[model samples]
Target chain A: MLAEREEQLEALLVEREVEQFLYYEAELLDNRELHEWFDHVADDINYRMPRRLMRENTASVFSERGYYFNEDYGSLKARVERFDSEYAWAERPPTRTRRYVTNVRVTRDDEALAEDELFVEANLLVYLSRGDSEKHTFFSARREDVLRRRGDTFEIADREIRLDQTVLSTDNISIFL
Target chain B: MAAGDKPSVTEQALQDARDSLDEGFFPLEFFHDENLHDLEMERIFGQAWVFIGHESEIPEPGDYARRYIGDDAFIFVRDESGEVNLLFDSCRHRGAQVCRAEQGNTSHFRCPYHGWTYKNDGDAAGIPQKSKAFKNLDREEYGLAHVPRLETYEGLVFASLAEEGPSFEEWLGDFKWYFDVHMKLPEGGMEVIGEPHRWVIDANWKTIADNFNGDSYHTAWAHGSVLDLELGGEETVGHAGTGDSLDRHIHCDGHTTSMRGFEDEDVFLTYPEGVVEDLFTKEDLSDAQWKLARQALSFTGAIFPNFGFLHFGDTTDDPEKDVAPFFTIRKWRPLGPDKMELWSWGLAPKNAPEEFKERMYKMYTSNFGPTGNFEQDDVPIWKGITESANGQFASSQNLQLNYQMGLEWMSEMELDDEWLGPGFAYSENLEEGGMRLFHEQWYEMLAGNDRTDATGTPMNVQEDQ
Candidate 1:
């Protein structure tokens, strides 16, 4: 006999549902559908990338002055606009990128967060193949996001990226990580 | 290709720079030459008060951050007693880089090369093979070699390679008012908000400095094409940034200074005359608020060396950082002659109301940093300038930036009493004059009380200040 609970936390936030959203977001970003991608974030979302520093093994760069990018939603849109325009020469040729966001952690019952806040962290790997450079270089980081859920949709209110690279070799951070 | 034939650009370029003491701006050659680049790093970058890192970066007792001055790597950290220290990020024992990463909180930094250890204060705490490496090495004396001097004002960290000079306060001089107004206004001094958005641009560090110091002229052309904003297009920022005009001034020891107001008919001339009267359809602001907004005046200037701050309120709040319009402090650290790593921060109004802080950060992030709204457009231009100036013809890259706005102070308006503040007054039009004033200080610091060459032909006009 199967007993159905009134509201099971697991069912409310199933792994398939969360992973589906994650993968879909990544595809939209990779494809440069910026407006569609922004729909997934909360209006007051905070996006930040703490710098990754070179330090002793026991120290975590996440805690120090290590930051790469810290921005909000409007700033994120402006960045996309730069790439979207011919004026944004950094990506005028439009550098293609593949983003992989893994290890999505869903904290449904986190007491520390506000009612609207949904916590998730994703480990991302970005591979960019630009111009004639044959040797490939990659970037990886762990993202801590405080996603806000409004009714049926979702938004990002705060996000922080902890990068693993002390010395960034990327041509430009025109793309959102 | 011969010195006498067409003349090697290297010789001709140096000759022109030596001869053209009147113009403060130099040729692109100074930025790209490998030998001169090396000398700049050793002398200018090495000896000057190179901005290291912000003090807020190392808030905790064991917090630390890494920085780059030219190719050099230095670390800034907070000790147990909470004092900021700058040290070469190298292990003294074996020369392995101690702080190999950008920043982190650490009780002790142990080198991976050979397990050498150092306390947060840069003291040699231990060595794995202590009794084996040598007979004896004093750990205290052998710890990290600190930058010559570590100093902080308004929460920004600055280090000088020279052990002696005017105090950072004195060197900063009257510029303290600028810093005090913006930086000191913030409650906890100011937090970096996040890591600095860093990128290697392909432009001379000096050019970038000149550009930011008060080249409002480019805003209309460069960012205008990019943002579609009608900044003073033909005019640079100093004399012609439409919203306002600045009378360029300089402090003793070479700090380029200014006084600004909204007078240029060139400004807002782009807008239909009396456009506000047409805004009768839009009825939100009271008459007083609207008048004040129109009356708002601003100041943008730089300290003699590389430290400069920009204060303008084109927009009251940045929608991105959720911070209000603010004063910004930025230092162009020369990574190379033609390469610069720009460190920028937003200074909120120290006395601003709470909601104002939020608006300032948004404006700052959207427009300024690695991912700034307007910033995204600027980096590519810097790179383009550096790339175009790299070849043989690169030597002849004549950026004959002019500086003859007000040739003599006697003819210029007095800066005091009649000026907006207590500063010198020169025409807002001669924008490059500030760059000349800056370089005059640069020469003074670099050559140390002399500009005469072997032929006694003065290398620079000593009167720029």
Candidate 2:
């Protein structure tokens, strides 16, 4: 954000901002406070995870646009309803998972659209443990975030999560990556 | 054939099964045995008409993708003439795989090991050096084996393993009307979004089919949150008798379709007030929404024997909020007696507006597939069934699936309900009749029995007998 924050916020390090965002988000998810996680998003946020294909170099595997996950704010809200409902059996026992977001990186291609738009690139490593079983392990290609500032705070305007595995080994994706 | 493959359905078993159907209901053992699943792979999926892809998948002459009918793999490609052809995946040379990738665009498919290439038309095109490899290798005789017969019904492509199974249209019969109305004949036929979202679970393919056709039972309690956002208050419709089940069921011709009325009794409410005219034509927009829901009108299209395409989702929030309806077609591929690989996809009219398409896509991702919010809970129920089948008493349980709603029990309601099928009752009690019908059809289809026999008295119903 080029407008520059008030003097109280200090000359914050890009590394520090990225790390802070990653950790805070992880804390919210780990604590199972999905509502707080939503607060991190801009009012009209967009999140996408286009499916990745495994193939030889220079060749595309599949580009079914709707192949990966795509979600808007209302749909995301509806998604959260699953956990909010007492009868949703998937979350009934309440899955215990932790998102270990790591490998933060800022590339030269980083660009800022406007005073409010901040585009940053980061690498993420998540370690997920569901109900004490070594069932699922996190392996996402990289996360690209397009954060926008509203008033005094940064919130997600857009996010694209990519997974390394073409096929998910776990049964259901009740929790976010 | 192995001794075990020999016909096990002796006069007694066949007579017993045929006899059981006389009164009503076949033995549960027909569904419980390994032989049944194996026979189905070899017979039904192996011979009957099975869908492979939408014509849209390979719009270009060189575009091609891999698919399967049961375990037999095939490749679908649009040839130079702009016609789609389905062929076995094997290469004519050395029997190596011609197209190794799941899907891609290429002028010619070449086998990796021996460098043999074939055209999209399923013909042998090249060798290391045609003249060098051998004095004479007939290219015409070495082309990729085109599937016995391939047909297209309303942009949906189907490949029949059996050369003589009922003609494609003959097979689909009256069901084609349903597909035509909802899927085909639409202003613009639908197209798949991406590589299918796939995940394996421990459950019968039947469980998944039944879930799609009428498991509204779980919606109230299981998908309470999804229902809450779309159908708040008593309008919540899918809760299928969990003390909250809705009043509906339509059954006919080995298929079951269900509709639920939630708070949004009129489904048209989901659309932007001004946009309805633009999205649906005057004919398509027939006061269909006002008849039932805030965003009503949902169908569970189950064409029996495990190939099920059903809309098991709801409409999203406000237009300013931008939420569209998400529809899904789930193929619960039976990996085993209790194992299934859910192959799912999201479909949208190719003619839909960009914004509407985005809305539809978002709604779909937010709810179905492995990462879908609403569908995530379904796996647990599937797993729960898989787990229960392990118990001694559980193993003996026969699952006592219900299907009591019949002409006798459901006729009265059909009289009162507008959503009932030509011959089905929306009663939850009349559930498992579908499962029995499927197993029965499965047995007949796989046994190499007659396919042209007289169908039952139902409308356009055709099955092996």
lDDT winner among the candidates? 2
Worst 10 residues of 1 chain B by lDDT: B450-459
Per-residue lDDT of model 1, residues B1-465, tens digit only: 334322333433454475464543456545466655665666566666667767766778988878766677887889888888887888886788877656678788888888888888888888787788754766768788888777787677778887776577766665464445434323344555445555555567776666655555555445553343222122222225243444344333345444344443222212222322332111333343233234334446676457766555543212232222445677777766566767676655334444444455555655566655556566766666666566656455465545444455323423333433323444443345556566554444344442111212112223533
True contacts kept of 1: 0.29
**Per-residue alpha-carbon lDDT of candidate 2 for residues B373-449, written as tens digits (9 for 90 to 100):** 66777787766665554344432443433344343433332223454234444444334344445544655665576
Residue lDDT tens for model 2, A64-122: 47455566786566566557766667776766666666667643234546565667666
Tens digit of lDDT per residue, candidate 1, span A1-177? 143563564556554566666788778888878878877767676777765545556455453433445556665555554455555555655567899888887776788799766678789998876543453457788878777766665666777888776545544576777
Supply candidate 2's per-residue lDDT for B42. Answer: 78
Instruction: Please give the distance, in angstroms, between residue B400's alpha carbon in candidate 2 and its true position after superposition.
Output: 3.7
| i-RMSD of model 1 (Å, 1 decimal) | 3.9
